[model samples]
Target: MHTIFEPMKPIPFSPPRIDEKTIEAVTEVLRSGWITTGPKTRELEKKIQQYIGGGPVLCLNAWTNAVELMLRWMEVGPGDEVIIPAYTYAATANIIIHIGAKPVMIDCEPNGFLMDLNKAEAAINENTKVIMPVDFSGLPVDYAAVMEMAKRHAGIYKPRGENQSKLNRIMVISDAAHSFGALYDNTPVGREVDVAAFSFHAVKNFTTAEGGALVFNLPAPFDNEAIWKDINRKALHGQTKDALSKTQAGQWQYDIVEAGYKCNMTDLQAALGWVEMDRYAQDHLPRRKSIVARYNQAFQSCSWAILPKMQDDIVESSYHLYALRIQGFNEDDRNALITHLAEMGISTNVHFQPLPRLSFYKNMGFQESDFPRAFEQFSNEISLPIYFDLTDEQVDCITSAIKDYMQSR
Candidate 1:
């Protein structure tokens, strides 16, 4: 008897959608010789602002840094508490800690990924300064409900800083890393909250190689444009003028206002984002939605499968991730299923492990058992590949692998 080896499928979990257009745009930026936070970056920011149709948009290096800047600007510090769901990625909670603020982790809604607004409301106190709700897997967390909750707690909100005083209420910053094109109440997500941060990381629906943006919709008298300018400075060592402006004749003189962090988006990175933005609404998003629809159809009849909510009357996801849940699956069962799928040459991932389960948050005295709903979600959740480049055949292969594994079990 002769032993033979089988070739594995070449399917990736999530890859950036790169094409000639992207290459050409990047090449153009490279040839321009003014790559760091120049015209290309500004162009991308303007394009994002126009597409969102919300407020001023400020594009920065990564989602984590961009949002951390916003938190710093809001003056959130040690004694302040920011409400967030424990079901999100570590970046969500890490940023809170980075800013010296306490992250008041709460449970997810009974059967959903979004944070429970009731739990969030109950967690509020005089120290509560912000409510950073994540749009997990691109599904919008009831923005209206979160906004109303913030408003209801206005009486107890303590404004420690000028920016916080301006709002006079707890700010609602949407961790919209996965929801660049999602809609809430038929409107784009950015406008729903006071500020929404979008990630253009390689794996996100919209990729910039590495980038993120903050769309400000702060209420009247706040001057979002002024805030955008201020954040631009804050993102660049608090410099009076960006490198692009400083390059001009007789514009060399500048001053630093605050000791800020360096996380400005480079022109080369923005070029990729600009090209993707061009085809996002027409090509990228539709294809992702189609893939999700196919997945939903493939698993809908299975008794063990629980399909993710992509769209409802109030919200529409960007179809960033197909977060499927296996009914009655425990942590061990889910891990085994993942291994089985891997053996079949299919790539799958858990959207998150829940912050409390991780070593850092756990040591912070955050227990997984305390947030039972979050733990329940994490134990059985599987994030399947859903990207613009993924073909229908690949989707079928993935679905077949999952069904085969579940049926065998």
Candidate 2:
């Protein structure tokens, strides 16, 4: 019974690849005695901005904060309606609820992870202030199409204040939690949209354990630096000075500009992020792509395989989540497949169950039946493991398992 596959070799869904360099970086931060938001945190922000090719980047505690902060900064409150896709995690719409704004959800495109832009256009009105599109499975949405849609509805845009007045259209803040290094037309994900918020959550391709950032790329008339300062201050209890500034002689006294929430990233987290960021495009991404290629090759001939798009000439993913779908399969079929995979020492996940289907949103009057496209995408979806450290053998085992189950039926 000789076999290449290790029967008991456990493969996690998305295990982080924190190497010696990352550990050393974090250890140095710990040894430096400046643990909380400090030099390392600021340095990571700058590095992210440079990598994004010109944007005022500000690090936050979570992607949720990045989304909420964008809404708060835009003064999108009561009576404002932010258009969103029904096919995303709750975090995307929860921010709108947090700000007392309405999240007008549009159904996803048929068999697609992204929102239906036509539905988005139809959803727009005088109350529409922003459009939050999720970068599902690390794939970039059509920013150009969304932007063009927003422009067409310019005449109906209602401005609440100076920030809203500057832009005579709906603001697009992409919830790019899964798309750190994804590309659209050779431009990075952050640059394509008005502003993009990326997550570095523990399971994400890029990890700081838990952190997020917003790329400030507001074109003309809008002071990008001022926007960064504003968001930075808001993320840190509205204090006039950050800890780095307070460390200076006679600068101990500071003013509270306004009541703000605390959502700043720590130096320890930033140290890990610095290491991950440096290796992302170079080492991590290439390996992840290879793993994906292995899965694609293995599943290429399967009749039921609806493989997740890796990339084409115009778009490339960060290879965050390998969300595979089983054609003509329902929720029961997908869950059974997950159970079968689990029995064989492989871990799998579902990309998302559309927000409308959740209990909370259901209680809030959202029905799963309303977003038919999203539900269709969800029912048969299963996210496979794809990380920098995932091996070709493991990919083969995982894909073989999937194909076996698929073909048996």
Candidate 3:
């Protein structure tokens, strides 16, 4: 009955850290019988607004929906261009194409996975309407530089040969899927940008099972209340009222205002979010930070390990993913290392493959050489197991496996 060599139970890269509170909240939601976009969802939105500072927060089914909805709200359409980082989840750039707008990919910073602000500025043209900076792996991109670039470009550029007062007023839409609890310059990620879409996917730090929230920081003339109502309509089949709204007596009558997508967050999902948010900073974040610190301490001595920067004066990551780069390793070498880790019962993953290398974007004319840094990082990066329940012993095993694999090679 000795099971000592039984593959160490297969440590997952990232798993939802659910607890009894989440269970109770979900059960309460089930008993309430009013589950679709109801009180709990509104409560979650209000809590998120307070958590990230004052801003309009709209809960949705996914960050993808939030991004697409924001693009639609801004009237981004065919012939319009949206600048995005080459190193990001497909959701960040895919929404641009989904709205028929062209996605202009930008390179990442050298030795960093964040968007290259200089390249982003250079990519701006007359047709550019949005500068979508992804907070890759929870590290906030330099928003100050991005905002400055947007301001500097405001007056000189002209779109469609029209003379507008500010040509450089590109909307700053942050793909903050990995940075919900992250901060830039002491301000939360959502509040700093014009708008940010946060993912609450099952594997995210904060899980809503399958949900997201849109944080809007656009200034005057763009009424936050109106925008909220518009997004609500859009999320629920363009209907004037949702299921909860219709539940009230003599209020069942509603109408479709415009053609919209079904992407509203259910109360069931929000129930989980409410509990997760309550414990976010006080409980969850601390544990994750501890795990990251342990991982950093373990791997910092390795010459071949290029660890991700977790914090600085201007940035504080959410510690969403630990992207470990294998220095001097090619794509094949990295792949071999991952395979070797798997053989030793350590689970690992890659954050992403640069969008340009994907067949869809490649066929759209993107070149790997177009973004050398992103490609370089993509070729050698591996995301290690990081979660609340991962034991210190498991962490040591993962690091040891990596070191053994590299040294033996």
Error of 1 at 222 (Å): 0.7
- In order, candidate lDDTs are 0.90, 0.88, 0.85
lDDT of 1 by residue, 102-134 (tens): 999989998899998898999999999999999
Candidate with better lDDT, 2 vs 3: 2
Candidate 1: C-alpha RMSD after superposition: 2.7
Candidate 1 residue pairs in backbone clash: none
What TM-score fits each model?
0.97, 0.97, 0.95
Maximum-lDDT candidate: 1
* lDDT of candidate 2 at residue 232, scale 0 to 100: 90
lDDT (0-100) at residue 244 of candidate 1? 85
- Which lDDT tens digits does candidate 3 get at residues 1-409? 1122435878887888887888999999899887778999999999999988957899999999988988887778789899999998888888888989999998889899998888888888777888888888899888878777766776654444221222337778888899989988786678777788899999888889999999877766567777788888888889998897787899999998888899999999999999988888887888888889988997898898898999999999999999989889899988988888887778889988999989999999999998999988998999998887888888877876777666666
Show the lowest summed lDDT stretch of 10 residues, model 3.
159-168
The candidates, ranked best first by lDDT, are: 1, 2, 3
Question: Clash number for every model?
Answer: 0, 0, 3
